[model samples]
Target: GIQVEQSPPDLILQEGANSTLRCNFSDSVNNLQWFHQNPWGQLINLFYIPSGTKQNGRLSATTVATERYSLLYISSSQTTDSGVYFCAVGGATGTYKYIFGTGTRLKVLA
Candidate 1:
């Protein structure tokens, strides 16, 4: 079993500001995914990087399996970015059981 935790439990930012969110896991995992829960409660898949860096638009993510941690970077954030970001990790057992991080709640002011 892997324990996942996210840093900066909460965040408030002005529009166009940049920020970083972190996710730490306690054990080794073969699957890792990042998701953004929009204000409307829809979950948007942001990344599926288990061990490398990836970028999509103004957002990017990096995962270092050796360090058991991952990072999400937001550049020039917008109000539309306000939401709860989650990191989910699944062990190598192929159990389809993924442990989700506590999540980082972000609010971008316009």
Candidate 2:
């Protein structure tokens, strides 16, 4: 089994401002994914980086499996980006389970 924790807990930003979110896990994970849940409850997969880094438009992610942590970066934040960002981790253990972090709530104002 794995346990996940997210920092800051919440965030508020003005439009165009950038921010970084972090996720920490207690156990080794075979798969890691970052998701953004929009205001309307639509879940968007932002990244699936088990290691290294990845970028898509104004969003990017980096994972350090060895250190048991992951990072999500948002650049040029927009009002539409306001939502709950989650980090879900899947363990390699026999049970094959996925543990999710509490989530980071982001608010971007105009």
Off by over 4 Å in 2: none
Q: List the residue pairs that clash in candidate 1.
A: none
* Window of ten residues with lowest summed lDDT in model 1: 90-99
| Per-candidate local distance difference test | 0.95, 0.93
Question: For residues 11-108, could you state the per-residue lDDT of candidate 1 as single tens digits?
Answer: 99999999999999998889999999999999999999999999999999999999999999999999999999999999976677988998999999
Q: lDDT by residue for model 2 over 1-110, one digit each (tens)?
A: 58899976999999999999999999888899999999999999999998999999999999999999999999999999999999999986756777899999999999
Clashes found in each candidate (C-alpha, N, C closer than 3 A): 0, 0
Model 2 TM-score? Answer: 0.96
